[model samples]
Target: MKNPETFPHPIGLMLFNRFEYSQQVLMSLSAQTLPVDQSKLYISIDGYSGSKAELQGKPDSTHAIEELARATFPNATIRRAEKNIGIAEVYFALEVSMLESHPDANWIGFFEEDYVPSPDYLEITSQLASAAQPIDDIAVVAATGETLDPDNRDVQGIFPIGHLWAYLVRVAHVRERRDDLEVFRQQMSGRPYWDRDKIALALVMASRGVFPIGVANDYQRLSLMFRFNRIGVTTGLSYGEYIGVEGEHMTEKSFARFKFSAPTTVPFDIATVDFSASISTLRDQYRADFAKSLAEQYVIPKIRAFTAQKSFKSLPRRRRVASLLGQAFRALF
Candidate 1:
């Protein structure tokens, strides 16, 4: 609030090789009502040395991304890793860089190249952050609101899930949890970014009472979120589109299996909403959605596996129907 040259909330973007998406991000960011200042924009890109062959002779993509970023903002601070240090490491390192660079900032917004943010992304997240100031447990604020139709901006409510599509994380929480992340990093020290068994990671996290999903980096945050009984809030209407039909973690086949109740656009003219009032509404919604998702994602497969057991099939029809549930319940609990 004291300096006009400094951005209200310093922000950064984490990316690998998605130049086009990064460009879109920069353009949208540049167009922010909250202008994207060179002093405020930081870019952290992962190395592509190992993927030079995969990238088809583009071993210098990090340089290209830097050039592109500077051309847009002209003074953007860019951190390019020399080797492929992995997204998880790059992300945390970027956070530390932002913290050290903008010591006065209370929070930092982080984005990925896979999603294209709404023009109002900065303003909305700022409002969300301001509204969330008193709520310590709400560690992050996102623009991932859900609507039956993404194009229709009726503002159903804040999304109940922790979506990193575009998010703002509180500095205090990050400082408090940095040690936890270091421990997680140590646990995953030698593993390549793409080589993680996400299912196993989710299962391990579930045992610790955290939501059982996301990549290694995302999982690390989720663990901290649960550790302090914190939650992330989102806009009432989605603030971006997911154009990552095929990226590091998704393929055309895998992407097709996924669906969104909302389509591919964010409302451009949203007035500032005081989301602090609706925080509990979002929390309640998350509880219900998590319960439903847990059942559908975990329980049904378990029931199917139970019914398929030879011993289960051998039981009389009446007893087998009831007995199948016994095993599923045991597995679930």
Candidate 2:
């Protein structure tokens, strides 16, 4: 068994033009009870390609991110991109590089700029990773999951999709499949879909039958169902809150609907977590939530918005008459 007192895995923090959000995550990291070696922290700052005139008036967060990492984590390794390679490429390059550089490292935890982790986040993640390292089937230990009830925190399970916001990755598993990941990354890059990159990672893992274990709420489970036919596993308690609602990709309203609060306290004993019951409960909750969302967001909305222009009262008499006739014929069916 590995030493429980020391956490030897490296952590990679991905950053872009979001200083405030990045700083918030850093602050939360500083509050972790687990002792992390500053030298093990790797920060990658992505570059911007816009013209000088375009950037002159805009606020750039990359510079601020470098400064913050240097000042706060003096011995940390910081890599600043010379060009804007996009987030997908950055993640691929960093993960590959880390695995290659540190062959003995068992796992690596990834943190995006906006994810604010709880005080015990590191401790919990290390413990979970330690437990998962021996399990050949478990590919990840995600910090977040789909929780059915917000008030209840005693849930755990395996889930299909993995959240990149905050999670401990099994380096050995990914390293062994580096070629596959590279091909997947190449295929997913430059896609029009906002989450294509994220989905690609999940797809690769799913193909290998290596599911992720973590905490997820009902909403997250439904989101995963749209991509994968199955929901992996989840726990009732959340380790941290996603505070980057106002970030580049998310709208304020959408963030408000999905943002979840972290649990007051998390169970530190990883072995005590019941995988069988958590998986069953998560699947059941997902089915119910998926049905509710389909009805409210799709079925009901489509039904209510099916009327012709005549329903607006501003249509010409002739058009209104035709619309009414069409509506009547449809109703008769």
Highest lDDT among the candidates is held by which one? Answer: 1
Poorest lDDT segment (10 consecutive residues) of candidate 1: 146-155
Assess each prediction's global lDDT (C-alpha) against the native.
Answer: 0.68, 0.59
Model 2: residues >4 Å from true position, as ranges? 1-6, 50-57, 146-162, 188-234, 274-333
After the best TM-score superposition of candidate 1, give how far the Cα of residue 311 lies from its true spot, in angstroms: 3.1
Question: What clash count goes with each model?
Answer: 0, 19
lDDT of candidate 1 over 219-247, digit per residue (tens) = 46854665676677665565677677647
| Candidate 2 lDDT, 1-333, residue by residue in tens | 323354478888887767887788888777677856676777888775541312556566677788987877788778887666666576776776677667788888778877788777787777766665555445556656534333333354343333445777676555555564455556555642233555455545456443322112112222433334444233446677777776445678987776565554645567776544455555565556545544554445444455433454787778767866665445322
